[model samples]
Target: MKKYLPLIILLFAFIKTNAQYSGALPSYKLVSGNDWAKAKNYYLLTLLQQDAEAAKLLKADAGLAKLTADKIALLKSSLAECKDALCLPAKLKFTDDEINTVAERLAALCKPGSALDKLIKTHIIPSGTYFQFQTLAPAQLLEKAWRQDAAAINHTIAVYAEGAKPNYPQIDSISYNVKKRGYYTLMYDCSAEVNETVNARSLFFEPSLKGALTYLEVNERMQAGDYEPMATTVNKPAADKVKLTKWANYPYTHIVVPGAGPDDPNTPFSGEGMLRCKSAARAYFAGKAPFVVVSGGAVHPFKTKYNEAVEMKKYMIAKLHVPASVIIIEPHARHTTTNLRNDARIAFRYGISFSKPGLIVTDKYQNDFIMNMDKRCLQELGYLPYKLGKRLSDTELEFYPLVNSLQIDLDEPMDP
Candidate 1:
């Protein structure tokens, strides 16, 4: 019996030590249908409580340990429903002093074949350790060290809402090629009889002598001494006439003047000015090019405008005797930028090359912006199978200056 006394005492000590190490880590449950931020807040509170209990255990402070343990128990009971649970050693609040103290205590308690020993082997060593201690068994020191490290990580995450910006892949370069080109012209809202109050819907010129006379004036002013009597041939003195392979007319498509919709009865003829302008452009291009590209689409979601291209094609066929097969209707373009990009793509598909000069027919006022966009599109095409040439000659520069003056003068009254 005397010889067996030491073994009995050892067993008792073992049982006593293990008695204190009861209870699982607080279970974290996210509230259902809650946003991530709210869930994270709940999770953080549980973790903070765990940290406090773990700290108390390291100090061999029974009163502090009991207090923290009670708090953790309460939290665990209150948790809604946890899908999964992780068991972790109690950790004190993250602080330099607390970490050092916990590290030292963990070293002292570490031993072979102990709970701490298994935890260190299973969780800590595989990951890494932050606290340094010589006397403690290295194999059993990980759990406490890991807890300290995790606490620090959490604190860091709390300080910065989001971490670091990630690096993205870089594009090396870009290339471009010009596919095709053809004659282009601009039509305008002009009247020889009288200056008209051009609104959104009002056709600037009637399909009569008045309209024809206005077109003539615009043509004469633009061509000056260079005006040809009829669309005879490509007669620019700079180059010999090569056989014309193809011809297309691209119209500005739509013009929506401000204050011209269902809400504005007073501006009943709001779009008329644009429609008239487009008509003139169509007539001019029909006279110049054998094949014309009509470009326009639906104006409003519920309503449709006379597609500038369709109307122009009709005018060309009915009035000018051009063949229906000569016109290509591109009705999908919604904005000026998209119109250029889509047109360039179409031109490339049709074998239009930079070797041939392309003309952009648009409103005189919008000529510069369209020309700039065209140049950008060509640049995007890069060095391709053929060269593309672009010339902006249809829209008179004077009209743009006049439009700018009008816009500025009306700015104050037009502000919503």
Candidate 2:
């Protein structure tokens, strides 16, 4: 049995890595700095703007120049025949040849000593603190990230091209226009087109480029900046406190409390949520870990103003008598998958030791579900955020942080 232990561990890892993540994910957000930004904005313009040398090379390159011109011409020609935003996506989406040309131009910039290589080293590489993209060559990493962004932009074109309807239509408090035709606004007025000249670069990233604009307009959360610069916003005092404490003495790095959103629309925090928070507070007092991370976002009951993590933190402090200095609030995870992933992300970014396992303290049902959460994580997050270790008890399980948790999932823009 002792000799077979190594083989058992290898088998578990093998099963996890091979989990299927098929089809294009619904959305994407590229990491600009510490925060994730809209993928469409980044790829279409921001990337070039940030790296002037690389931008100059791409803009000057004959391939991109010709591709841009051709795409602009195509869009200009189609504008007269196109009736509305719905008719423009087919004209604006990248063709295989155009994509290949763009890829080639970007590939040129990945060479050693090039401007893009420098940008990659300084910006892209450092964004993922855990060296998430170390396995991929610079070119491969750039191409993969760019392609995913393109796919996300294209997806928005298809889903929100006509215009997105509000996710919660039944709620009367939301305006009629918001309820009926979310993001009815457009970048260009298509009401009666006689054609003004479109910018070459903008033309190069059409339909979805337009769709990305509408998506942001509809979501209206492009700039909420909820708990951003989390290094300072939520983790500062706790991180500072942790610095003076001896981590080796604790059995766990942190006691993670994944938020259980309220079922009632008007309710800010649920009973189940309190149960989870109480469990974590108990673990903290017992010296299970040095910190308590309450993980969640504005999710349940759709468009509810209350944030689960924020509410939970209040509960723990006011009700449980938990010290504010020892609690970290992760207020941007919309789902159970992100709850775990975001918790791990907070742990990694806040100087928590990945070598030390974190204990997840939740209700028995959630704890049991977590034991089989690998499939769900893979399906939604494309990789397991943490490696599941031993189950400490009925309501507590141990998990080690994974570097791959840094890989941003753009599907949930509000939280990503």
Candidate 3:
């Protein structure tokens, strides 16, 4: 028996690793901290809530039952300063043992690389005082069910309202990879209701102030191109820069160059992005394509003042000596999801049925991601707008109406 101790410990560890946490979690209400802390906790709780709700829905899903069961159990027994309201000590010096002593399994469930941890990585870390987990209810959907029937939602609040301060379903933007249609309005309404009914600040993001928009204000924005007000904030190319020819009778397919990073002042364009732009130029000189579409915005390490497509266009004209007339500037995409979505958006706004999709010219890794999209990508982006093959890898990609037709879901974010 003494000789078998190590093997027994190894077996126990394996079980813990694979074991699903099945804990009954309630709606969390954190005593608000700093902006980063609040935002970080907000998203973390949303992730936890989403999983919790998902576990409930998948109770009968044979494959997921065990995993969901494990999650549920772990959550119910997690160590906390206090069960419902976790109030840290005034000095806030919490050793692992101190935290674990309060609630045995709490820290392990919320540890880094956990499912909950992955979801909240969007936030930048502060000085050691941050943590991150949820399942969503069916009726919580915005478009078909809840938006269609506001009364249904009100009834839920009426039924669940407790002690004049009900635990309502939350609707925070950090929970989603991107916002869907009516997201802002729905959040605005739900948040308003929470404040008015429960006398608490709305956990969800509210788009507008001074009440919901009248019909005219909504129409004015919708009729405009892409309907994103924040596009105006993006840096534009020189006023005199030439626009490319329309899609119809444009002999060759456009080579799409999605922007990579900020341009270096010392050199024209440096970094992996320069390689991507150079790749596009090489394809252009080879006569593989006629036009080039440089798609990117002031993405990452935000407010760097360098537009990826604009810098690429400059590099193309000065370095590669590619014709300026052939390049189309799509200067508002913040992510790859937007990279594909923006191309289709700009195309339709310019022409009716001139061409299908632009041929995407990007790095090998990015091209592979587009080619072999996974579940998380599909869920966040909603669709892959372009068709990809080896011929298109780092050279070209096709755009289809089915994908382009769906709205770019980044309808609203706190930042543009």
lDDT of 3 by residue, 1-416 (tens): 99999999988855553231111111122222223211222322223334543223223333334333332232223322222211111111222332233122223333456442343232211111121111222112111211212222222222221111121122111222113444344333333332343211211211111111111122221111221321222222311121343445443456778887744433434477778888888877887655677877654443344566778878888878887766777766666766766665444433323234456778888876666663534665455545543444444555442223223232222111
Residue 122 of model 1, lDDT score? 42
- The candidate 1 region of ten consecutive residues with least summed lDDT is 407-416
- How many clashing residue pairs are found in candidate 2? 0
lDDT pick, better of 2 and 3: 2
Tens digit of per-residue lDDT, candidate 2, span 1-416: 99999999998755553231111111112444332345322432345455668677667767767776776666676656764445564565656666666677777767988777776655555455223444577776666666655655554444444344322233211222322322233423431131343466533444335445444444454432476656565768896786687888999999889888777889999999998888888899998898999988777776677889899999999999999999998887776787888887666656677777999999999889999999988887778998989998988999987766767554444544
Best by lDDT: 2
lDDT of 1: 0.31
Measured against the true structure, the TM-scores of the candidates, in listed sequence, are 0.26, 0.78, 0.41
Candidate 1's displacement at residue 55, Å, is: 59
Residue-level lDDT tens digits of model 1 in 47-151: 222343433333354432433354344224323222211111011123354345444555555566654565444433221112122124554444444343334
Runs of candidate 2 exceeding 4 Å displacement: 1-36, 39-47, 69-81, 88-96, 129-133, 162-213, 221-225
Which regions of candidate 3 fall more than 4 Å away from where they truly are?
1-252, 262-269, 352-357, 389-406, 410-416
